[model samples]
Target: MRLNSLYSELQWLPRAPEDFAARLKAAIGSSETDVGRALQRLANYALDLNRLSKLASAIDKAKSGGRSLQPLQPFRLAVLSNSTIDMIVPAMVATAARHGIALEVIQPSYDQVAQEALAPDSRVNSSQPDAVLFALDYRALPLKLSPGDAEAASATVEGGIAYLQTLRDNIKSNTHALCVFQNFVPPAEALFGSLDRAVKGTLRSLIGEINRRLADFVTESGDVLLDVNALAETVGLAEWHDTQLWNLAKFPFAVEFIPLYADHVARTLAAVRGKSRKVLILDLDNTIWGGIIGDDGLEGIQIAQGDPVGEAHLSLQRFALELRQRGVVLAVSSKNDEGIAREPFQKHPEMLLKLDHIAVFQANWEDKATNIRAIAEELSLGLDAMVLVDDNPAERGLVRELLPQVAVPELPDDPSWYARTLAAAGYFEAVTIAQEDLKRAGYYQDNARRASLRSSAGGVEAYLASLEMTITFQPFDATGRSRIVQLINKSNQYNLTTRRYTEPQVIAAETDPEVFTLQVRLADTFGDSGMISAIICRLSQPGEWEIDTWLMSCRVLGRRVEHMVLREILEHARANGIRRLTGTYLPTERNALVKDHYAKLGFVKTGEDDSGASRWELRVEDAWPAAAPMKVVSHGFARPKETLSV
Candidate 1:
């Protein structure tokens, strides 16, 4: 059968598990990219245990044959697992592979996690992976102490936390690998059962304390801790753990649920690679609410506690509200009269989401693809960062066909399943939630206000000046290291070198005397755009410096932020008696916006390499041009007392 035919069949083969397996195998055999797409399509279908098992086998087959599942950007992952992870490896690799992560997971010898992770000459440390997975379990913890022995239990908790911290410190100080640790899942048997929390020294309580300590550790260290406990609770304790498998292979979770667990890992790892979806565009009718607001009217619509159908929509609205709080920009793309669409948000008493909650509300008769594009333009984000959440398959298909860059999730047929379906999708996974994330909705709202102000100001320069923006440049410190690494990994459009660096790498660069590393934060009359840009340049010679990484957040684009960053670099170069500043434009599929970045900044092109990379340089002997329009301030570095031209 044709590849498209197989893809089409695998999407909705409800009754034919055998046929689904056969079709999936054929799809994988045909082409790697197409098969990846096919696997994504199949993710929408509710796969039975038999089908999932067969799919796992097919994934192993495809992986062993050298098919590149993650064609975009691959992550070098090493799992320093304490348990028998051999059974989980295939599904883990397959699930991650489906998500565009070339996940080559190296399973260190079972129970040898410390040796592999801490020792410099050990295989895992020697490989120097981009990220290391510390697949930990309850086995890492000691046996429960006496019920009243609170001191001993506390010591055990502290001991475990210290062990994790020491190992992480060793790895981090020695290598640039991100430590992805797994939070402990409480063992099934507890001394006090459900009442374990009533006493402090209980085993369950100790595990809980350990988990809490792990969270605190990650918060302080900027490491990643996966919440396997939450995953187990969501999947159900009865279904999550298999006694037979655990006894035989030390697998913490059931084999069938390994795929789901793998998906969780993949999403977390993908977030580290800058693959989280930023904007969530929701369709109004039957998606966020049960009935069409235009025809059903605000009161008549099904989005309240009294009706079952309405409650489903209410649950979905609640989920969306949480996402908004986490920095996901909520938007609306609906085929309805604009005035009528605003009624539900305005008048519905049971509506959890108010008008102010939505950053972009495009409720009109226009095509959804067009509306989505407008939303992207307004937010100054790429289509790839936007996710379309519509209940209608036709509408989803239209956006998927037209704006293939927008992620359109496969919605379940039943409206009641919408909330659960979207919850499980994990499209908005984030590695770190900075203070700036909590204020993102306000930032987007401020953007809208800026747009209105710009239209009235009559000129770009005048509008920018009217905002009275001030940008502060500070050296990367311990507190801001996580956000800096995030910007380095995620910022694409305005990036020059498109270089991604881990926290350790960034920390190393900060102390290097020959390197200048800075974090840029912007504020205006409207609000603060936190840590919007980063610059890393190394002294190439006695009189010259080379730009290693230059990137700015898309939210602060078109605001002359780049100009300010360049000016700061130039000032530092001039202050240190440097003669020339050199930079390169390394082309990438997403960073075309920066192709002429040097030219725009007055850096003349010196040469072009065989790989299409262009070299640019500027002689610092001449007076620099006028400073950037915004008020620029410097911190953590020496500034020239005299005026320096940019």
Candidate 2:
């Protein structure tokens, strides 16, 4: 099949890796056009031995020929493993290149993961990786226990885990890089064969117990965990590892599965760097359901029960519902009457997703690309954080062309494959799921209420007054750390400096006398906006403070919250004898919203850094606003001894 038509007609099913690789190489090298899309299609192929081999070969050729492939964003990746991993580097580079991550890997000596991670001078720490991945294996554990020696086996497991934990703690203490912990997979052989299932001292039981502890550590430490055991099971354990390779080359896992493994690691890295998507814009007719909603009508659409086609659509709805439950914002952008489009969701008894589940619904004759832009604007999210799903290839193609930043995954022609396609894309992956996540949909719903209020108010100032909004500032407490870290990491558009911090680092900053950390929560008469902002300030001198980090949730923008926060910061600084405050605005592709932030707050432009980041300074004597625009409440360390009540 022709390359353009192959993708245009959705005929690019998962081919044998070699067949797909050869086709992709030709398609990629033949044209200087749509090279990204061609690679994306190739990446969708199910990973296996042949596929990894062919993919590596294709990537090697592309590199050798200096093909016009899209340039990858550079990322420093440090991999410390007990097993030999030099062979995995090419595959890691290849898979990451496909995903737009130019991975520069740092490999430590075999079995020296802990040593390398703990050494302050080691390359693992010196490279300053975006993240450090520990590729641990069962070989790292001493498993020579005889039957009935359960106590000894348990001790060995405890000691090994303790040593691993110590290494992780050292890394956390020494560096700011995120840690990706890959748990060990149980070796296939059991000392007691099938009886290992019943024996606590068996090799299988010991490994399973170790993994259980590893999972607990991951949760408690707030580190990213790669369940290699789960991946091994998914690919079948026997196929995932090779004993001969382990003995000959110290390659613990099957070489063929390196691509898949790299995919998972790269995904987490992308999410950490704020490249992960948030909103899912879905199409209606033949996309969410088996037929056109406008033509098929509410009762006629095959969305529920009994028939195969109906089941497919039902599964898609259920999948979308699940994503919504996990805090993914769902919106509709279809070419149909808004009323007609919402009828099925309103009237259908069997509909798994109702109208209220959607954060936004824009169903009209307007082109989808424009409507999607509207959705992002309304939701206060960047287009890069959206994933558009549509069954119609034309719609997908148009959106892809118009908004290259938005992830437009190609849906399968068959309805039966819709849910599977979306799941396999892994566009949405969050490190931590908190209560804040579950309540996110409600917060957006409240945004709609606020929008309604804005339209009705007499003017912007009148609207701000009528809302009875209150801004409360609190110290960085444990109760709010998860959401705070999440906001620090995921927040892009409204962030100043755009400095990402992990939970441990944030916690460390909280107790430091030189650092002042505050969490901002806002509430209007409508509802609570949750913890909406965070600020980290460092004492540069006895009387001078520097704004280390300041980020606010996009949902609370345009409410003069920034003014309120700045006002309170000045008040607190004055009270504590801090004479001047210095702040920097680091320009990232996503943080343009805050370019004029310091200037608007009356901060003087001090100078610009080599990287073009602007620096500003505000004197405590700078006149405070004559009157507060909104009520401000301060608590904990952020609270001042005296303040204006309103």
Candidate 3:
């Protein structure tokens, strides 16, 4: 969509009432489950910064008033900026609320980026934020446009990078926070017109160099990059840079773009928290083609290369295919006869997506919400991990009402904007793509076949043996660092501790003598399931080890992967001369599946609080065989010779 239409085309249902602020005020002092639907209904709208600020203010009141906001992840963020960001914090909180995060931003006094990041006792470090956002631009760094001085230009870029890197290193060392860097956005006032990009010493060229180098730095550090430069360019540099506002109060960009900027930042934080959407549920008919396939037979549907309407649908198909290739699970939830839905994929020439691309196909006449839930069940994922894109506003509205957790972005009357709208929504945000990620769609497809195999195998034991699964248990190493961190953050339902660890923290575990870590993988007759589990244990005393982190991807839930993983843990504990193993189940709205996790594995329950969180202890000497069908592949604690990069 055009920059002019950034806030225009989303017609998502259950729009905020005219008295939205009043409703938010009333929502305070109420339980989240009781007020959750109302909160989501209000948050569903494409609200401006002013409205968002009001909503955020109410949420803050509820938090301070001791009302519970369960199911919402709380994130403390330290914002180290060179400009005025006080006006932007509320919008950030509100947008993060839309993504199911209660964001608390810590902003120091104006232009204190250097001192706050460096001083150990600074306000930012005292809060111990999960993330530190370095919101610096060209003016915040040392950049001088010396004409005919290419050597000086190079020094300027290196110096700026060094300055930022020092801040990131200090913050990380002080508080163990992941750094988020914002690349500088060049001003629209180019002195040399198009040559600004070509000249080495020009401000535009300097910024170009900085942005490129910034990406490399972020990749190497395993931190995050907020490409404000790209955001500004997307909105047109003219619209992004407000000269008057900057001169007045040092606003980083135009106030109009604050809402969009906040939304992007929130989604990034959600991705880091493993809350980003995984599945894209698509509606057929005018959505993918010109007419209903049932009415217009396979030959009559208007999906062609030449026609404008057909081309629009084709664009969306291509985009979905690209997403699937990059690890997004694509599902079809159309209200059509299964045979009719299959007809186009089997026979249509211009169709870009085939049946093979879909991980789940629910073409029944059931309500869209029901079918969407069915899709989630079939894939072993949560409703929160899905985004429903439907052309019908009524369907979108109903889905929003019944399933507030699912993301439903409305499509306009025209079909062309469908891809743009969905792309701009940023539902399926990811920070890193692993080898397993590229094959996620294929893994779901394989899961369907495995489910079919289970039904005919007669008994659970027979089914487990027929697959011939192999469990690979290895300590965390360089090769699997990225995927291990991903599992630690994302796998909520099967996660025992529901702990989140940054890449640096994961790396730290590798060399720490007091800690032991494991990365688990499984492969069966069907396919390699990749690294599905990660565990970390810290030495609690002279003879005991406490489970600091334990999580598994839910995709392998019923296959007895956890049994095999526990077996490895017991073996390692025994080899290390450990006397006992302690495990705790910290309860959350999403982790009830694992409340009795330790109990299921034969540990004696020691205690539980009112909230049902429990602790368990297992004597390593009393451990027996885990007895799963999977063949074991033991790496035997092959620790890395050197620290691995993430």
Candidate 4:
């Protein structure tokens, strides 16, 4: 049960393979269990260890290649501890070192120090460490008797919580730091049952309150929260259980749980500490089925309420739902009739995966590789963040060969193992769930709407106007900070400046006099695009402005919204005494679509780089006419009522 011990055993599996198996066998004990079963379990463990090693290697390779492996940087962790700091602090430090992260242990001795630590004016002591790892059990918070005293205690707890928020808020918003809350380790009921139920109840209540407040603050602030309770529970209490003889035992919890816990912490840190994958490509037919509904008919397909295979498919759908819930964009690429293949999703009673769940679905006779490319285009997601899941090896092979960037999992033939394998692959680990994560699918669906409108409408302008497209431009606010940072980090296509700003960077930009940061929200008859786009621009001097950054949510592309945004920025620049507007087109693997954007916008190129990046400028008099009559919405300022002649 001790994760440390588990890690030790796993570590031995590679160095002393025979000794590792022997120890495992001794642990299992001779109960007439077959060698095959034991060997199978050992093999599975070995495979998991190998996967972890590969992941570590990948991290090293990325770092060595200067790929910006964000998780490896020094992380600032706030360790809140009252007692047992000796036991927990070392364990945390060991875990942090294993992942190449620095831990900042915050142990306040008095209420004054606690207050000082949590004060808004208090700077994150760089001497202490980059991120915070909060290690305090709930008992650290003050508890008192008088109603007034209780109020004071409550205020202190709230203040402490706010201090954590302020530290998170003021720090570089884009810095990959996590505030992990470790829930109170429940005391053994056998030892403490008769001690004092009231005390226990109070402690429990305090812990619950801390969890509630911390969860809300972390989620709202877009900071990462490590569900230590969930993780500990997953590993099981028996493995991590508090033992009376822990101080005496050299090997705690069988020496295997140490590495296991370390591994979990490392993986969690890696997941939360790094960038999130952007796209999920799924296969249809047997992958989502027991039989092809296209050829077998809806009734003939294997899905049913009672069948095991059908139940397995349903379970997979539930799994997919969980991924969608976490903001990973889902796409379907199947070799079947577009209509016939979608029948199950539409009509099947057992089906939990709805049509709306998918953002880009390609149901056609085309090869999966071709279908995947089309899906990527439709979703505007780079091929790199994509994970293609298909049951058929042939289709997987095609995708793997043609779309090398796409992650294709080698699925087992058995239907029962499908869900488990996908879960183990860890493709959907979300480090920090942003508001945009929840609405990503809806945004993609909005893109589908725009596409449908364009196809149905007689002309491009008609489709544009029919979208009822209103671009709401607002200066960067707290609510929109995460989206802006996300765009700065992930956006490639249509990005002018390509300046990757962290959350802290964005916050700092707010204080600059020349910087103009705007978040664009688009909505039509479809639901709110929910802050789907962003623009960051700055003025260098009088009569001159540079487009530092401009990007629309991939979901909003191809609708001429980019043009509308460009025109708006130009209009604003003109009003601010800017006679010439300058912009840069940075070349990236996926941003070729915007290579000629400046030229298209009527800017004459003054210089060009070997990488195809061009420097272009346009005078106010010669700029493209702002005649694209799109409705406008501005927050913090109103658009001019009188149309100014461009």
Candidate 5:
């Protein structure tokens, strides 16, 4: 929502308040002494003010609705720098606190001291903090070169890249943390024509190298990279240069820029810290193109490259492609003739996204909700993992009413704003992409292959065994933390006792004396499901147990893996002399598919609650029907440990 606020502010800046303009002008008025510094300060102030106003408006909106805005949880952040940048610490701390994050300054006694401390052998542990901000100033580097020394300038750029590599290695060895590299801001000499043109060129080359290295590091390590240089450029450096006070005061940047920087840092941290939406469900007709294909015909539909309306659609397609490259799955769900709706994607000359680009395609005359349901089923993703994009408010309302878990972004009246609006929403902020993430869409596509194989087999057991299905069961451990937490948050349909837990909470839950946590990973001839399911249960007493949580990845749902997992739980319970197993079904908008699950499992209803949640129990002796041969390889413990410890 903060992202939306910032975007809305940017969209309406041309008509911003007179006071806002006056404040900006006043900031620039003192910036005349040094054009570059003044311009930077002015730009910083404008951006910051925009961020602050948006944040304030969001808070007011929340309060007016009788809902209090919850602050972000406190996260420890380490600022790694030297004395020269100590003054920046207070502003950073203030910004962090505004977002409910706590900043801990980790200043080295000197440059050498800091470098030595961050070395691989040093005591410094990068992962100990959520993130580390490296404020390395290139001006301080010992690069002996004159204005015209092109060779020397090239060497300086190379040295900067090498230093980044060193930093990457050291951080990798020490912590599971994110690294943000800040390029040094050029001094006034380079800006005011005091420095030779050649020297300026060398400095520019060094900055470019830093950007290159940072982008590379991000791609390779999947770490967050904050491009301060890019932010400055976005704020317009030339405009700030006209004001001179920034050069004179040295700290002339407005208070507003500090929070803008903080917002960027927070966004990066969020991306690196949590799971993001996995699927994008797009609507056809006006949503994907300029007009309805059903009425316009293939050629009549406006989707050419040169036309303005067509250009808007092209931008949206480009944005979708970018999301796909970043690992977001794309699916189509529209209410039209399947053949008619897909014509543009298949035959249009300017279309960038083809059928192969999408993981699932559902174009029919069914209601949008039904189409979305089918998409989720076909893709093996939960409804919550999807965000529906449609220009029709009525369709958006229907999905919101029927399936609350799916995020339906509000569409702008102007089609040109569609791409920009989605980018600002930050719906796809994944922290890290695991091996499974990169190939998830392909894995779902393999379902068709599985269906073919099933048709050839005589029966369920024979099909499963012939495919060489192997289910690996392991106790909750550090290696499977992300998958476990993701299951808790995203899984819904097959989930019993739908309780969501964060990573830390999952870890803490494992330490309970009565609790048992298990992860299920299945692999057969087709491919690896890669830790597709999780179950959490607790012993109520001797000979009695309760399933506190149970969820299987939708990908593995129809495989009867859920039945296999329940049987495994029963085996563990029986071995411990548990005579009965209990479970509950709480109704949710998206979980109707599982309403009769307990009954199908032979669970006798013992009672019902006012909220419509049903309580059921199964006798251990007759728990499950005879199940197919499921080979489970167990790890950690065959029985509960004598004592539970953190």
Candidate 6:
């Protein structure tokens, strides 16, 4: 965000240290097998191209030396564009380091978007990249100004999407790669003053129509869409486009904006790979409002309307509330008396954020680093899944040094820009939002109520019985496909194999005769937690079914949801004449929580691999005993005739 052209819209990653050159050298010379976190810490700084280029060089050296970037998942990306894409690849590779992705790029020849996608033997297809980015601009697209003919303008718009659709379809069919298409950025040159927006046949109108339609295409196809038009508009259209540079070097935009562009693209990649942050930890005192409630008292604080200083803080509250509504869990990390912190949220009439919006609230004199870790533990989330926003530089620096995994964005001095700066950070970039997602914060809050009930109940059986939980089981269907794919990628800590599946692959499993899929939802007396668990089992042999994926939301971890899920699995297996169920536990940095998952469910260990992946098997002859106390509702597949007795 420090770059003058793209300020106020991207993350204010920390500035480089005075000894950054030496640090970069040391990182490159590191003998450790994996230098991912070390390099990621460096890339999380506010770096210009010169520094980014040096980091890129160091990354290349590390790769050449046969080192690993373990924490960063390896991603093979193919970029198809009409402009000078070669110059942009290095920055992308370097910036992707910050997003926990080790990017392996395959760049076909410049302006080969059509040829590379269509040709069977093309390098783009042969690369078999995980994703294909169609980085086309307006000029590269089929758009023309008819100057007054609406039908001609409509034809141009229709033709533009058809062109992109053909390329997208061909690339996907050939490589099975998820298509990432960027909408066109129209030039600053408007044909008529202000009329360009309303009049058909104008270049502005034609480009707008295409971009709008293109967005719908990506949504329907379950692919990714990068709104370059919105990014350019935020940066100022005049500053975003460099006509002279395009004529000189065939550059799509100014070279200076490459770092910002790369950051956006890398974030999209991270979101697709399920690395997006989930929690927003906010500081209360001068951060959310004009004054501290602990000292200023309730009436002394400035948070109401008609006041300039007060409205600024209100803006941040409004923004945080909006993020919470979209599944970004909210937490409060404050150094104040607990009662004082609660007073503002409870008593302040103008506060947009109530106590209900927050999933965790840490109010104490302890250091923020400790409180942040506590919040993570309570939420059952990772430190890397959080972003801490504080008004005080000291608190920010303390968190940056102590909890390096927690993203500490640089805050501007002006309180008015707090919301805008956080908005620009894009730490919670999402490709899709589900109904379950919208109520995620409420789910965590409901978990707290369950905890309270458990504390007073004094026994596990009593607590379980008091909650009155019910779980519904249904086969994978079109209505639940989006949430299903999301939970598959996002539920890392509870996943057994940690395998990723694209939309098309999940669709294939829906009606596959040999495949079995289950989508489970849980509801208690307190509230309904949407789609808390999912399982996929594949036919391994005539009488054996292998559990390809078994994952659950940790919100229901201690509630015996696992036992209930296994019960449902047994019912389906028995109905299908499956005698054995095979389960695999592939170890990862985050999934150790589930290392003993299968073992706890009475699975016998069968095999172990060098990477710590262990396989287990369960033999089923008849109905398996249900271990949990909750009632289950199952609508079994018609072929096997599965049923659950109340």
Each model's TM-score, in the order given? 0.89, 0.86, 0.96, 0.70, 0.57, 0.96
Write the residue-wise lDDT of candidate 4 on 1-646 in tens digits: 3423322343222222445535444523423323222322232233233333333333334334544322223444544433344333344433443333433344444223344345544333333433455544434544332222446546655765765566455433333334454444433333234433333234434444556688887776555566655545555656555464345532223233434544444445545443346677778788877888777898888777689988887777778888887777788888888999899989988778889889887899988888878877767777767888788878776776677556676666677667765664455565555687887766777777667767889887777667666667777887777767777766766666556655556777776768776788877777778776777778877888887887766666666677767777777776677788888887765578788877877888989988688888888767675555456766553353433221
lDDT of each: 0.78, 0.77, 0.84, 0.60, 0.63, 0.87
Ranked by TM-score, top first: 6, 3, 1, 2, 4, 5
RMSD of each: 4.8, 5.1, 3.3, 9.3, 11.3, 2.0
TM-score of candidate 4 on Cα atoms, chains taken together: 0.70
TM-score of model 3 vs. true structure? 0.96
Shift in Å, residue 283, candidate 2? 1.6
Q: What is the lDDT for 320 in model 4?
A: 81
Best candidate, lDDT: 6
Which digits, one per residue and each the tens of the lDDT, describe model 5 over residues 1-646? 4433444243321222446556434533442333222222222221344434443333334335544222233344555543243344544543333323334445444454246436755434633655566655544454444346666666766676666667756765576445666655443234325344325345554465556766776656545566656555555444213235344443323333454455455545544433257888888787778888899888887778888998897788889888877668899988888888788888987778898877788888789888888887777666767888888888877886688657677777777878876665556765555666676766676766787788999887688777667777777887787678667766766777767665546776677768877888988789887888898888877777888887877777667777767777877877778899888888764567777777877889998898689998999898766564555667676653321111
Candidate 2 per-residue lDDT, tens place, 389-424, comes to 888888877886688667777666678878866776
TM-score of 2: 0.86
Q: Which stretches of candidate 3 lie over 4 Å from their true place?
A: 1-3, 7-15, 32-40, 636-646
Superposed Cα deviation of residue 64, candidate 6 (Å): 3.8
lDDT head-to-head 1 vs 3, winner: 3
**Against the correct fold, how does model 5 do in TM-score?**
0.57
Error at 433, model 6, angstroms: 1.2
Give me the displacement of residue 45 in model 6, in angstroms.
0.5
